[model samples]
Target: MAKKAYIGVDGVARKVKKGYIGIGKNVYGPELLSTAGMPFMALANKYYATHYHVDQDGGFATLELDTLVSSPADIIGKWWPDGSFGSDSVETMITSRIRTAVSYSGLIIHTEAYEITEQTVGIARKIRKAYVGVGGVARPCWSGGELVYYGTATALSVARQHLAATSVGNYALFGGGETTNNSNVIDAYDASLTRTNPTTLSAARTQPAGTAAGDYALFAGGYGSNYSSGVDAYDVSLTRTNPTALSAARTQLAGTAAGDYALFAGGYNSRGFSAVVDAYDASLTRTNPTVLSTARCDLAATSVGNYALFGGGQISSSSSSAVVDAYDTGLTRTTPTGLSTTRYQLAATTVEDYALFAGGNASGGYSTVVDAYDASLTRTTPTALSEARYRPAATTVEGYALFAGGFSSGGYSTVVDAYDASLTRTTPTALGEARDQLAGTTVGNFALFAGGYTGSFSNRVDVYMVS
Candidate 1:
């Protein structure tokens, strides 16, 4: 009988000529097998004849023909016929079977020393976990635990906990009062809590005007045991054992600091209400006092860029005057512009280039009207306040001009009202204490009200922190 062979053609068993193989409809050419230098059909026949058994009917028996015709060790050294093999064929077969088994088993294939070129292993299944080289030298080795990882068996771990934290937007408040010592007291607050003690003033006083120059707060004339002409210097950021006094003693002075100098304007002195203006430099030396054409007290004063303005106040006649004066600081005092109505003891705050003058004592007692003036002393038509008052303190906080603690119609007021530059006033908020003649200063985000007279003279210091 001619040598018989069973071949798999498209997964179906078929009998073919011993020297030929069929693929699809056409039988393969002899050159196709000959050029490849292999009798594929003959090899298949030999494999089946030697390994498979014949059945009772003389036809080839169903054969368990899965046994290898060549050992893996043997296949390693040669091709099928001449005992020389194609490159990596055995390794390819083994790796293919391994990958298939691993996939079928649903397990991760751990590997070592696997080459990672653009081809071959690059395209291999799950090769990321595979090993390469015979000695397992190249491997995906991890030295540390899950919290750590390895690169070349070196452990690198991350911090399981966090690091230290820091803070921002923090600030300090300086030069105010507390609940004791009627005068000569200076305190500081931070973060809503008092951070410093009341640094004793050189002399006890209230309603003294203050201006900050660097770390120092220069306090000009205010009512002490008497109307004080004495100017005192307190280091706003430091504890004071001693304070330097002014060349002249006066009170109800309006002052503002600019650059290295603090300027004090019209105030009440022993000579009565005076228009004297004085400038104190960094060295605490006072310049010769320049006189204003109008002598007044309880006026509002502020520095706008290069010019200092002194607005409505009580004239020497004890009547409120509408005069507005501007001091060049570099030059002598000039004639002042008059207001629509006379006002005194008013609260003044600067908003950009304009100064807003709010509630003060007008002709009929306390007037609620508010006024605006440009740095050049041009006045705007007055807007009315929510409540008419005098001895009220004004400060600009967070773009709003706040008027706080003054004597109104009934009595002393703890009411706090805020006005925008547009002259619109908001509903007032009550303070912790009702007071008048209070010295108000702003430190950071908080406004400090210190040493004012309540129904009785008070040493109570209250702070308002604008959130």
Candidate 2:
């Protein structure tokens, strides 16, 4: 007679003889087992195959078996031995093949691994509940295909549409064109300009100084068609024609808006570059026109709070001087501060509390060095521009000061460079046109260029929008 062997399921072990053991009260015998596939038979044989069996006398008997039974040591060494018939090591070896077969048959199995503790099931249930409301069906931990869930329908639709649309490149508003020797014909354009002339000068002239006043604009001291001493004004909000002229005739001057007045300083007159400092009120009235301690022209000027800075220019004998001077708008002309770097035909703009000056002709050649003066007119160490140029136009936008359109070492440049408040210099963007001695103004977010000479002279105006 055959000896009996022991088998275990769900932690319950029992001895069985030649007759099959009943699972769930259903007997699995030869007839019932024959209908079962080879896979089920293999699973049973792996876990329950026995080489040594118990005899009726309670002694162990050896049986000749096609497969060897694993020792208890070997069984204990296997991972997941009690949980499943195959060990993790064996499962790993057949994983690729099993995955391939299942994929080919379009079948998938969901398996989850977690700590076997009382709290685990509750955590899983909560996760399922949270995900299910969004069109996700919670499958049992043992069941798996691919996890599917629905997102916000409206948001998904919008995102999909946006992805399908065209991509756009980074763009900026740039100075376009300017007027000729005649300042009266001021015109500037960008994609937004669209054939409309936004602002015009009070008179036709070149090398005039311009600055923004309280809701008004002051254009002072430019050579007219006849090089006449002319100053003009326009109500910035109304866009009206020349409202009035300056009290004096001067050209090649520098001016900055300080407080309620646009202070005009040092420029060439019939008497040559004067050290004169003139202030124009919002009513277009000139007052307290005082002579600067040092006479200069083709220089740069900017206002920071109470002080107006005048920096670098040619003296009466065409000699360039590196003199920086500052005048207090609150006080009269007696007191002025001096800058460390004296540069001429440079571009300057106010960034926060600091006024920056960059690129101009110094000594006999163009310079790349940039300098700054604080509200107190104290100098900071100068930085270098990527290129050396003179007579460039500078304007401030979004904490950045832009310098563009000037006579550079590479010739007249359409290049635009921005000086960050941190005093870092960046590579420039080329303008649509190459010109020098242009005037740049920032209104709202737009930088408008008017009346620059392109070798000879041009009447085209360009606008760059900092978007």
CA lDDT for candidate 1: 0.53
> lDDT of all the models against the reference?
0.53, 0.52
lDDT of 2 by residue, 95-179 (tens): 4323443323222121221111121111111111111233474322211111111111111100000000000011111111223
TM-score of each: 0.57, 0.57
Which predicted model would earn the best lDDT?
1
| True lDDT of residue 369, candidate 1 | 76
**Model 1 / residue 214 / CA error / Å:** 3.6
After superposing candidate 2 on the true structure, give the runs of residues whose Cα lies further than 4 Å from its correct spot: 1-183, 188-195, 198-202, 225-227, 239-247, 334-339, 456-467
Q: Candidate 1 — which residues are off by over 4 angstroms?
A: 1-182, 223-227, 239-245, 329-332, 457-466
- For each of the candidates, the C-alpha root-mean-square deviation to the true structure, in angstroms, is 30.7, 26.1
Query: What TM-score does structure 1 among the candidates reach?
Result: 0.57
lDDT of 1 by residue, 353-413 (tens): 5677777888788878777776676777545776778878766653456777788987888
